[model samples]
Target chain A: MEAAVEMKGISHWFGKVQVIHDVDLSVEKGEIFGLLGPSGSGKTTLVKMMTGLLRPSKGVVQLNGEKMPSLKQLRQFGFMAQSDALYSELTGRENLDFFASLYGMSRKDRHLRMNHVLDMVDLTAYASRPVNTYSGGMKRRLSLAASLIHEPELIILDEPTVGIDPVLRQSIWSELNRLRNHGVTIIVTTHVMDEAEKCGHLALLRDGRMMAEDIPSQLKSKLGVSSIEEVFLHYGGGARA
Target chain B: MNTAAVVKRILKQFHRDKRSVALMVAAPLLVLTLMWLVLDTETSAVKLAAVDVPAQVVESIETEGITVTVMDEAEAEEKLNEAEIGGVLQWEDGAPFVILEGSDPNTSGTIRSTLQKQLSEQNASMEWEYWNGSSELGLFDYVGPALIGFFVFFFVFIVGGVSFLRERTQGTLERLLASPVRRSEIVFGYLGGFGLFTVVQSIIIAAYSIYVLDVFMAGNFLYVLLVTILMALTALSLGTLVSTFAGNEFQMIQFIPLVIVPQVFFSGLFPTEGLAEWVQVVGNLMPLTYGAEALRDIMLRGSSFESFQVEVYILLGFTTLFTVLNIAALKKHRPL
Candidate 1:
C-alpha cells in the first residue's frame, strides 16, 4: 500500500534564497504526523508542496502513489492554512456550505455535514453570525470546521490551534484523535511543543533541513531527554550524538 | 459546476456587505446625476458687450438670454481685457464682426453659440438642419454613455479585484485549492457571481441617466445595456486577473491609476483627434475603449448592430483572455 504522502529529494527556492532544502519524507496512513519547526524554518513551504499548492524546484511530491498537484488527487485532502481563511462577510454555516459544494457534496450531505462539523468545532450557536463578529479563537475553530467539512481522507493543517483557548485546543486535538481512529491521516505543522507531543511521529526541521524524523518516544530515548523540546533544542543546535 | 457555489457565496457576501453594494450602485449614479445637473445648468448666461450694433440686434440677442451691455469699441476692449465680458458684437457694413475674449473655452463656446443662434433667428438667414442627432442634443448626451461605461468598469473592477485579493490575504483561496474545485472554477465562479450583480447595476445606472437625467438616446436602450454589461464583464475579468499579482488590498487599489484611469483618458471621453498614433493604439488595447466606442455608436450615432460587433467581439475576447490568465495565475497558489 502507498504511504499517505511522499516527498523525495524535494527542494524549493524563492528567488535567490532557498526556502526548503533537499528533503525526503513518507507519511503513513492513520498516523498523526507532526512537522515541528520555528518560523522561517520552511515547514509551511514543505507542507504546501504536498498539497500541490506549490511545485518543488526539484523533485517529486506524491500522495497515495499519485504524482501530486494532480486535480483528482487534490479532492482527497483538506487544508487549513496558517491564517484564518474564513470569509468574514459570510456566516459560519454559509462558509462551510460554500466549501461543501466545492467538494461536490450533495445538498442533503452538506446540511448534515455542516451540522456535524459545526458541532465538532462547537460553533453551532454562532453558525448564523457573520464571521467578522467571531472572536479570534472562534474564527480558528470555524476554519478547522471548514477543512473537515468535506470529510477528506488526508488533512493538512498549518498552525491550526494558535489563538484557540486551551479547552478548545484540547477538544480539537481530541477530535483529530477521533479522525485518526477512523483511519484519517493528518499532517500538521506547528512550532508549539505541546502540540508536537500529541503527534504519533514527528519530523524536527530546522533551517529547511529535516534534522530528525522518528517516533516521539524513540527520539526522546535516543536523546536521553524527558521532553521533545530538549530533543529539538539539541538537534536544532546541530549537536548530534 | 462549482462556479454556482462561488456565485452563491458572492451573492450572500454582497447581501451581508450592503455598504459595498450601495457604493457600487449609488456612487456612480450620484456622480452621473451631478454631471447631468451640470449639463442642464450649462445655460448660464454669458456677459457680452454690444457696440456699434443696432438696438434691434441687442434686443434680439437679449431676448435669447445673453446679458448684453451698451459700450463703445475701446470700452468693450477694456472689459474684454478685464475678463468682464465674453465677447463684443458689432455690425459693420451689414456684416457682423464679433471679437471674442476667448480665455475660458466653456464661456467662449456659450457666447459664440448664443451669438450664432441669435443671428440665425433674428435675420432668418441660416437653416439649422441636423443630419443625425437633433439640435437639442446636449453635451451630457454625448458624454453620458462613456460615463456609464467608465463608472461600471471602475466600480466592478475595484470590487472584483479587492474581493479576490481578500481571498488570498484571508487564506480562503488556499483552502479552495485543497478542495476538489479546479482553478478555472474559482475564476468562473467570480465572473458569474459578480457578472449578475453588474448587470443590475448597469440597468439601473443607464435607465436613471436616460429617463431621470434625460440624456439624449438615439439607439436601442437594450443595446446600451448590452454594451454596459459587456464592459462590466471585461472589467470583472481584468480586475480579478490583476488581483492575483497584488499582495494586498492597497496594492490592488494602486492599479487604478495604472490600469483603469488610463482607459478613461482613451475611452472617447476627450477627443482623441489630436492624440498621438501610438496613444490611440494603447487605447485600443483597453477593453473600455471598445465598450465606450460601442456605447457612443449606439447612443449617439444610432448605428446598426454591425457597427458594434467589433467592440462586442473585442470585449468578449478580453474577458476570455483575462479569465484564462487568472486561472493560470492561481497556479502560483495551487499548481493543479
Candidate 2:
C-alpha cells in the first residue's frame, strides 16, 4: 500500500537542455513498475533521480517517506545502470563479491547471497570466468545479478533486458515476479511493449513528461486500445518529437 | 574489512593483466640501461696548440695525454677563437703563459690541469693557479638523481592517471559509485590498490639504479626507498586526482605537458637559478621539486632523515591533500 519511491514535480536539465521536466511518479511497494519510453525519453534521468544518483533541478524525491538524496535511503536501494558496469578483469563471482562487500555484508551473508543471485540468474557455472570473457547476454545477466546481490528492498534497473534473448528475457521476468512475491519493489525502465505489459503498474513517459500512470491492462482498457503499444502510440504521437 | 576487499580486488586485477605487469617491470630498466651505456663511454682526446713554448715543455704536454700542435702566435689565437683548440701556451718572462678557451668548464679544467701537470714535471718550481675553484661537482652527478626522480614521476603519473581515467570512462567507476560504499572508501581503495604495486616498482627501480647502474648512493638504501615510495605516493594521488578532470585516456595524456612536464623543469633536473625569481618560485610549488631534492640529497649528499624531514612532510601533505580532493571530486558522480 505504501509507495516505495515518490517524485513530486521533479525537473532536471543537462546544461541548458532540459531532460526531465516537472514530472511526477510513484512506485508502490511489492510491485513491478516499469517506466516505458524509447531511448533518450528521459527514462534514465528519471531513474537516476529516483535512485538519488542525480539531484533534481526543481522539487523533491522521497524513498519510503525519507527525503532523498539521503545516504540512509540510498543504502536501502540497489541500482543497475544501463551500461554493464562490471569490472572486465574480475570474474563474475569476484565482481559480485566486491559489490556485496561494499554494502557491508558479513562474509557468511555475502557468500550465501552471491550463490543465491548466481543461481537466480543461472550463471553459477560461469561464475569463476572473468566478465570480459562473457558474451553480451551473460554480462547483462551478471550485471543484473550484481544489482540484486545485496537483496535490497527496492531495485532500480535501467534497460535491463535490452540485449537478452527472448527465452532468457522470459526467465528474467519470472524472476522479477518471484522477487515481487517476496515483497521486493522493482523499478524497470524499458521501451519494450511486452515488458511494459509485464509490470504490475506502468508509468508511460515521453519527452520527459509522464503521459499516463496505471496498471497496464487498465491503461489499455481506458484508452480503448487492444495493446499497451497502441496506448503508448496514442500518447507518444507514434513518431519523433 | 573494506580495506582488505580493496586490496584483494586490486591484486586480483593486477594478476590478470600480465602485460601491464611486465611493462611495469621492464620499461624503466630498459631505459636506464641505455642511459648507463650513453653516459659511461670513454673520454675523448684533449687537443692543444702551443706557441713559443720550449721543445721540452711541448714534449712534457705530449707525455700527459695532450695532442700538441705547433703554430705561430697568430695561428694559435685563431685556433683558440675557433674553439678548435683546447688551450694555447706561450712563453713570457721565462714562464709558460696559458690562454684557454673558457666554454665548457669541464674541458677547460681538463686542459688547464693537464698543462699544469706537464709543466710541473718539467720543473718542480713551476707555480700553479686555477681559473676557478675545484669545488664544483660534475654535471652528471648534479642531474643524475633528479633524472631518477623525473622518470619515476613521469612514468608513474602517466600510467596511473590514464588507467584510473579508463576505469571512469569505461563505466566501472559508475558501478562502484552505485554501491553503498562511501566516496572516501573508493579513493582509499584506489590508493591502496595502486600503492602496493608502486611499492614494488619503486624498490626494483631504486635497487637497479643503485646496485646495477651504479648511480651514486651516498645515503642509506632504506632512506632512498623511503623517498622513492613517498614520491610514488604523491604521483599516485596526483594522477588519480587529475584523472577526475579527464574524460578519456587521450585527455588524460594531454595533461602530461600541463601537469607533468613543467614539474620536471622545476624538479632541479636543470639549473633554475638563471630563471626569473618568480619562475623559480613557481618551481618551489611543484611536488616534484621536493621529491627530486629529497631523492638527490639522500642519494648524493648522504643526507640523514633529520635533514630531509621537511621535504618528507611536504610530500606527505601533497599526497593527503590530493587524496582528499579526489574524494571530493567524486561527489560530481554521486552526490550521496
Candidate 3:
C-alpha cells in the first residue's frame, strides 16, 4: 500500500512572505507520524497542505497515491483543527451528528458511530451538554470525537493537546496507540518533546525546513544525545551557526 | 446531502440560541409599536390640489402645513384618484367641494378641518368625499405596511450577518470548508435553514401587525405572508454576502449604517418621488424599496398579485444575485 500522505518539493508563500520552504516527506500507513516543530515552524501549514486546506505553492500532495484536493478522497481522513471549531450553543452529541451527516452516513450508522466515538472520547455522559459549558479538556475531546465520527481511515490532528491536562493527554495518546493498532494512519503535529518521543517516526522541523527524519531512538542515539530535545538543539542551534 | 447537514446544524444552533430567536421576533414588533405610538400623534405635510379656487384660499391652506397646487379640475381629479394629492378643492355653485384621498386619516382630517376653517370664513358650507379610505383610517394604517417590510429586512440582515460572522471568527467556517462540503452547499444550506425560520418570522410579524395591532389589511393575508417571506430571503442572502467582508461582529454591525440604514430612507417610509433624480435611482436599487412598495400595494391599495408581480420578481432576482456572489466569495477559503 502507498504512504498515507506524501509531499514532494513543497513550498508555500502568503503574498510574498514564504512560510514553508522546499521540503519532501512521506508518512507511512498504519503508523503514528509526528511532525515535531516549534511555533511558526510551518507545522500547521504543512498539515493543512496534506488535508488540501491550503494548496502548496510548489509541490504535489498525495494521500493513498491519489493526488490531493480530491473531494472523493477527502472523505477518507479526519481533521481536528487547533481551535475547538464547534458550535458552543449546540450539545456535544449534536455537533458530532452534524459532522457525521456531512459524510452522508445513514441514520442508523450515524447513531452507532456517534455512540462509538463518544464512548472512545469518554464524553458519553456529557454528550448532551452544550459545549459552552464544557471545560477546555472536555471540548478538546469532543472535537476529537467529532473528527472521528465519520470513522475515516486517516487522521490529521494539529496541536490536539495544547491546553489539556497531563492525565487526559495520556489517555488521548493511548487512544492514538489503539487506533494505530487497528491499522488507522495518524499524523499529529506537536511542539512538546515527550509527545514527539511517542511517535513511531519523527520529522524535526525548524524554520519551515526539515532538519531530521528518523525514529526517536535513532535520532537521539545517532546524535550522541540523551534526549530528543538535545538532538533538536544540535540540529536547530547548529544550523544557525 | 451536505447542504441538508448544514441546514440541520444551523437549525440546531438557532434553537439553542434562545435570546437571538426572541430578539428576531420581538425587536421588530417593539419598534413597530413604538413607531405607531410616536408617528400617529405627529403630523405630516398634506399636498392638496386647487381648481378655480381663490388664490387667497390657496395661500391660507399652505399656512396650515398643506402644500396647494393650483391646477385644472381634470388634473386635480386624476391626482386625487391616484393618491398623488391628499385632497382636491374645487368651487361649485359658490361652495367648496373637497375630494379627500382618505387612505391617511391624519392627512384627510387635517385637510378637511383646515378647509372647514378656511372655507367657512366665506360663510359657505364645505362638503367632502373620500377618494380611497375613510376618515377613520389612522396614520398607522397608512404607514404600517411599509414598516412591516422595513422591520423584516432590518432584523434579518442584522441577525444573519452577525451569526455568519461568528462562524468565521469562531473558526467553525474554516472547519466547514475543510470538509468535503462544497462551498455552494454552505450558501444554499444557510438559505434553506435561515429561509425556513424567516418564513415563520414573516408570518408572525404579518399576523401581529394586521390582527393584533389592527393595521389595515385590504388584500389577502396569504399574499402579505408571501411578500414578507420573499423580502426576508432577500435580506438573508444579502446579509450572508456582506458578512463575507466583515471580520467580526462589530464589523458586521458597521455595515448596518452602510447597508441597512440607507434602505430605510429609500423604502417608502419617506416619499422618494420629490427627491433628486440620483436619489430615486438609489432607492430603486434597494430590495426593501421594492418590498415596501409591494406590501403597501397589497395591504393598503388592495392590489392583486399581477400589480405587485414586478416586486416579487425583483426581490427573487436580488436574492439570486446575492447568493451567487456569496458562493463565489467562498472560493477565497477553498477553491474546490
Candidate 4:
C-alpha cells in the first residue's frame, strides 16, 4: 500500500535552463514501474532525484514518505546509473566486493551474493579479469551485478539493458520480475517498446513533462493501437500539453 | 564501514593500475637522479681562453684551470659568447687588464681571482669568515633539502589530482555519492589510502637521497621523514581539491605549471634573499615554501621541531584547508 517513491510538482533547473518541469509521479511498493522516455526527456534527472543524488529546486522528492537526500533513506536503494560507473582498473569481483561492503553486508553474505549476481549476469568466468578488458555488453552485465550485490529493498536502474545482448536482456528482465515478485520495487527507465510492455506500470514522458501514466495494455487499447510504440507516440503527441 | 570500503577499493584499484604506481615512484626518482647527477658532479674544470695575456700569465692560469685555446682578442670574445671558454683572459687598458667572461658569478670569480693571484701578491679583496656553516657544504647540500620537499609535493599532487579527477569523469564519484557513503568520508578515505602510499614513497625517496645519493645530511633523519610526509599530505589534499575544478586528466596536468612550478621558484630551491620584499610575502602563501623551510631547518640548520613549529603547522594548515574544500567540492555531485 505504501509508495516506494513519490515526486510532487518536481521541477529542476541547471542554471537558467530548466531540465525538468512541473511533474508529479509515484511508484507503489512491489510494483515494476517503467519511466519510458526518449533521450533528453529528463528521465535521468528524475531517476537521480529518486535516488537522492540530486534535489528538486521547486518541489519535494520522497522515498517511503521521508524527505529524500537523507542518508537513512539512501540505504534502501540499489542504484545503477546509465554510465556503468565502475572502476575499470578493478576486476569484476573486486568491484562487486566494494559495492557489497558499502552496503555493510557481512563477509559471508557478500561472498554468497557476489557469486549469485555474477552467476546471474553470467560473468562468473570473467569475474577475475579487470573490467577494462570486458566488452560493452559484459560491462553492462557487470554493472547490473554490482547494483544487485546488496539485495536492497529498491533497485533504480536507468536504461539497465541498453547495450545488453538479446539473450542476456531476457534473462535480466526475468530477474527483474523475480525481484518484483519478491517485493523489491524496481524503477527502470527505457525507450525499448517490449521492455516498457514488461513494466506493470508505465509513465510516458516527453521533453520534461509526463504525458501518460497507466498500464501498458490499457494505454495501447485507449490509443487504439496494438504496439506500445504507437501508444507512446500517441500520448507523447502533446495530448497532456 | 563505508569509509573503509572506499579506502579498500582505492587500494585495490591502485594495485591493479601498476603504470600509475610506477609513475608515482619512478617519475620523481628520475628527476631527482638527474638533478643529483647535474649538481653532484664536481664543478667541471674551469675553461679559460688566452687572447692578449702574457705567455707567463696563460701558463699560470692553466695550472689552476683549463686552457681551451689561444687566439686573438676577437676570436676569444667569440668563444666566450659560444660558451666554448669560461672566460677570455686578456688585457684591456694595460694594468693587466682582465677582460673576463662573467656568465656565472662563481666561475667568473674564480677566473678573476686565479688570474689576480698569479699576477699580483696583493689582490686580496676581503677576508673570509664562516657564519652559519663551514665551506664543506656542496651545491647538492644547498638544494637537496628544498628539492626533497619539491618532488614529494610534485609527484603526490599530480597523482592525487589525476586520480580524483578520474573518479569524477569516469562517474565512480557519482557512484560513491549514490551509495550510503558521506562526502567527507570519501575525502578522508582518499587521505588514508594515498596517505599510506605516500608514506612509503617518502621513506624510499628520502632514504635514497640522503644515503644512496650521499646528499649532505647533517641533521636528524626522522625529522626529514616527518617533513616529507607532511609535505606529501599537503600536496595530496591540495591536489584533490584542485581536481574539483578540472574536467579531465589533461586539465589536471595543466595545474602543474600554474601550481607546482611557482612553488618551486619560491620554495627555497633558489635563493629568495635578494628578491623583492613582496616576493617573500608571496612565498609565504605557497605550502611548499613552508615545507622546504621546515626540511632545511631540520636537515641543514639542525633545528629541532620546536624551532620549526610554525612551518610545520602551516603545512598542516594547508592540508586541513584543502581537505575541507575537497569535502565541499563533493557536494556538486551528491548535494547531500
Task: TM-score each candidate.
Answer: 0.86, 0.83, 0.91, 0.85
- lDDT value for model 3: 0.88
lDDT per residue as tens, model 4, A119-206: 9889999999999999998998898898888888899999999978898899889999999999999999998999999999999988
TM-score of 1: 0.86
Against the true structure, what is model 1's DockQ? 0.71
* Predictions in order: lDDT: 0.86, 0.81, 0.88, 0.83
What DockQ do the predictions score, one after another?
0.71, 0.55, 0.65, 0.62
lDDT of 2 by residue, A65-121 (tens): 888877677678788888888888899999999989888899899999999999999
Clashing pairs in 4: none
The sequence of per-residue lDDT tens digits that candidate 3 reaches over residues B1-336 is 999998888898889998888878999999888987787444566888898987887888888878889999889877865568888888888778888877766678788778888779885667878877666778789889989998998899889888888888887887887778888998999999998899899989999899989998888899999999999899999999999999888889899999999988987666555688998898889999999988887887687899899999999999999999999998777666
DockQ order, best first, reads 1, 3, 4, 2
Note the B-chain TM-score for every model. Answer: 0.76, 0.72, 0.88, 0.75
Q: Which pairs of residues collide in model 1?
A: none
By the lDDT metric, which is better: model 1 or model 2?
1
Instruction: Flag regions of model 2 displaced more than 4 Å.
Output: A238-241, B40-141
Candidate 2 or 3, higher TM-score?
Answer: 3
For model 2, the local distance difference test gives: 0.81
| Model 4 vs. true fold: TM | 0.85
Compared with the true structure, model 3 gives a TM-score of 0.91
